[model samples]
Target: MSNVTGSFQLMKSLNRSLVLNKIRSAGAVSRAAIAKETKLTPPTVTNIVNELIESNLVRESEMGTSKGGRKPVLLTINDQEFFIIGLDVGARKIRGVLTDLNAKELVADHAALYQDISADQLTERMTQMIEDLIQSAGVERTQVVGVGVGMHGIVDHEQGVARFAPTYHLKEIPIKEQLETAVKLPVFVENDAKAMALGELWFGAGRGCDNLIAVNIGVGIGAGIIFNNRLYHGHNAVAGELGHTIIDINGSPCSCGSFGCLQTVAGGDSIAERAARELASGRESLLREKIAGKDEINGEIVYECALAGDQLCIDILQETGRYLGVGMTNVINLMNPAKLIIGGGVSKAGDFILGPLQDVVSQRALTDEVKQTNISTAELQEHATVIGAVTIVLADLFTPDLLNAK
Candidate 1:
């Protein structure tokens, strides 16, 4: 009896979510349209929609164009009434966004991360940032349905624990549990890249794409993969660790203690290292005039110099692109994703980086068809990861996962 009751309840919830999402994706949809499209009977759609309307998640909007008799009433998601808190916890900074149910930004906040900070300190900073976001938005705590965290490094998404953060040298941090406790709401944690990939799928470049890879090339390089419209986490949940992919057996040492890893050669920090090395070798370029020493140098400085037509900066970026291409080529040949999206700080280099990366792909991919694989920069740019975090909560609220019944 209990099992039957559980199944019925689960199906009811799914039907409700189905009707709500149809209205959300349509921007404005009639009840008849949702029933026709979802294949749900009109009575079932009405009951579910009524529940959603009672919950303030769905509302009747303008009437649809008349077909024959009376006009049908259209429905829309209560996009602004509810809120979600999203955080992007990176190596050097913790960034956050307060977004509506539609993923529209309401408030943004950020705080720096010290190199020697402990796991506890990191959690404290993250918690403080969440509190600040809610306060800044002046929204009631109950109005926020959930909190989503996009954390870099190896994440145990199911457990909501960060297994290992290579950059932070921390392990087994229970992010979801802690945040949920602090905020008294559901909290979701995922690898930053995976979250970004889902975000792209939901609202950015990957909207209609079924199979794609969204790569984040920042202080470290990571990838988020979607296969057949679903996020694919490998057997060990480390499916998209693109940075650690060995590219050069005899290349520079990586933080992972491996020699010739892709990140050691193509990541944001790596870009700065290469530029600083060239400057150290007394290469005559604009970087020499911009900064005093290697300690003060970073990827943004290199990009600025490259924009000023500095050949050395341009070369470094191009070289980074070539190395990234080598890595991406391996990925393309293996996964055969329909599109490859480049995001993260390093991706800001634009043509100086993408041109060479595409050139390498055009030259090296397996066949003519594969070489035509579309490679593009991220649409959301700086907000990509953070928006992705918001999508975590939004997806849970709007998407109907059958497993929830299990």
Candidate 2:
């Protein structure tokens, strides 16, 4: 009897969520329209919608045009009053945003991450940012639905733990537990790149593509995989470690302790290292004028120089693109995602890198269709990862009672 009751409740919840999502997708819809679209009986739709309205998540709007006589009352999502907080945890900084239910950013804030900061210290900084963002947005804490964090490295999203944040050399950090404890709000933690994929799906480049990949090529390389409109977290949650894929057994040593991982040659850190090495080898370029020494020649500086038309910087970016193309080809052949979206600092190089990367893909991909697989830059730019942080909470909120887990 108990199991049967539980199943009944689950079905009801699923139907409610279905009706709500139909309303959301339809923008402004009549109750009859929602019932027809979701295949729910009118009575069930009415009950669920009434419950949603009471919960302040849905509302009755203006009347829709009538076919003949009476106009239908339009129903819409109560998005304006709802809020969510998003955080992007990076190697040296943590960026945050306050957004509405529609994921429109309302306020943004950030804090630095010292190289040697402890796990507890990091959570403190994140909690403080969430607090500060709520104040900045002038919203009551209760108005904010939840906090979402996009953390780098292997993340146990189910447990809301950052299993390993490579930048801080931290392991098994209890991000969700600590933040929820501090803020008294729900917290979700996800890998930075995975979050970016979700953000792109709903609000950016990967929109309209159910199966896609978003690669973040920053200080390190990472990838987020979305299949059938859902994130694919592999067994043990290391599914998107695209950076650690070994392409060059005898190539340079990677931070992952592997020889010739894709990140070793294509990541932002590698871009800078390559530039610095050229400079150290007495290759002359405009970078020498901007930097005091080779050590100061980071990836951003190299990009700046490239934009300033430094031939060496441009060539290095081109080479990096080719390497990325090679790495992407392997994955494309393996996964054959509908699209590949590139994000992060190195991607900011734009045509300097993209042209070559595309060239390599065009020349090397196994099939003609695969070669033309709609590779584009991430639409959200630098905010991609952070906004993705906001999206995890949104995903949870939107997918509460789905029959199949996303």
Candidate 3:
């Protein structure tokens, strides 16, 4: 009799999660709609929704229009009842955002680190930044349930350790433990690119797609891979280091100590560095007049100059895109994803970069079907990683364990 009761309770919890996810996806849904979507009995849906409402996780909204009967009341997630914090720790900056359960940013703040800083200093600064973001948003500390952090490096998500960050020249830092102790909250850490991929999967371009790739092109390059509607962290949790793929065995050196890696040609820093070198060698371009000094010539300035028809900037982007296409072709041949989302600052070049990239992918990928993969700029842009950090918490909240606990 006890075993039968336990089985029934497990089924009930599963049913509740199914109904809650149905309503969450629909945004505003009627009870009948949830029942239909979840294929659960109307009474079961009613009981689950009532429990959710009583728990303040869901609320009844306006009445829905009737289909020749009494109008049904609609339900919506109580997004404002809880909050999540997202942090993006990049090589040049550390950004933090306070967001509601729906991943909408309430407030955000960032601090620049132009030079390399110690792991301790970085943690201290990040902890204070979280405090500042929470205070600026005027949210109660208890309301903030969890914090998610995304950083550039090979991160061991399970252990919450940063194995290595080539950009920061750091190794084996227990970032998650430090931040969690400092802030006194649950903390989850992930590679920035993987976080960006999760952001797209939950709320951005890859929302409806199961197989997707989010490639982030900034000072360096990295990819987040989603397979079968789940994030694929390879056996060692380093499956998506697409940037370090060797496209040329004897080309320019990369920061990762590899020769002719894809990033050396396509990354934002490489593009800007190439442009600066050209300008230093007495090559005349509109960029010369647009910038105050040689140090001012970066990826953003190069992109802006390209938009203004500067030939040098245009040529540099075209070359970078061509190299990117070579790297992406390798990705497509291996993964054959449904969507390839290009993100980070470099994607702002838009057609100037994508046009050349698409051209190369068409010529290089294995088959016509593989080449047909949809490639586009990330919809979330600068906010992808930050919002993805918030989704890390949301993902946990939606897990079966937590749902069953509730």
Say which candidate scores most in TM-score.
2
lDDT (tens digit, per residue) of candidate 2 on 1-406: 1232223234446677687777777789998888788888999889888877877788998769978977779999899878889999988799999999888999998887888899999999999999999898898886887888999998888889998888788899999999888887878888899999989988899877889999998988899999877788876788889999998889998777779899989988899888988989999999999897554778888889999999999999999999999988888999999999999888999998899988988999999999898999999999999999888877766654211233
lDDT of each: 0.86, 0.86, 0.84
lDDT of 3 by residue, 240-340 (tens): 89889999998999888889999999998898889989999999899888886555778989988988988999999999999999999999999999999
TM-score for each predicted model, relative to the true structure: 0.94, 0.94, 0.89
- Of 1 and 3, the candidate ranking higher by lDDT: 1
Each prediction's number of clashing residue pairs: 0, 0, 0
Candidate 2: 10-residue stretch with minimal lDDT:
1-10
How well does candidate 3 match the true structure in TM-score terms? 0.89
User: Which regions in candidate 3 have their CA more than 4 angstroms from the true location?
Assistant: 1-17, 30-51, 65-73, 291-296, 399-406
Local distance difference test, candidate 3: 0.84
Clash pairs, model 1 backbone: none
- Rank candidates by lDDT, best first: 1, 2, 3
- Cα miss at 140, model 2 (Å)? 0.5
RMSD of each: 3.8, 4.0, 5.3
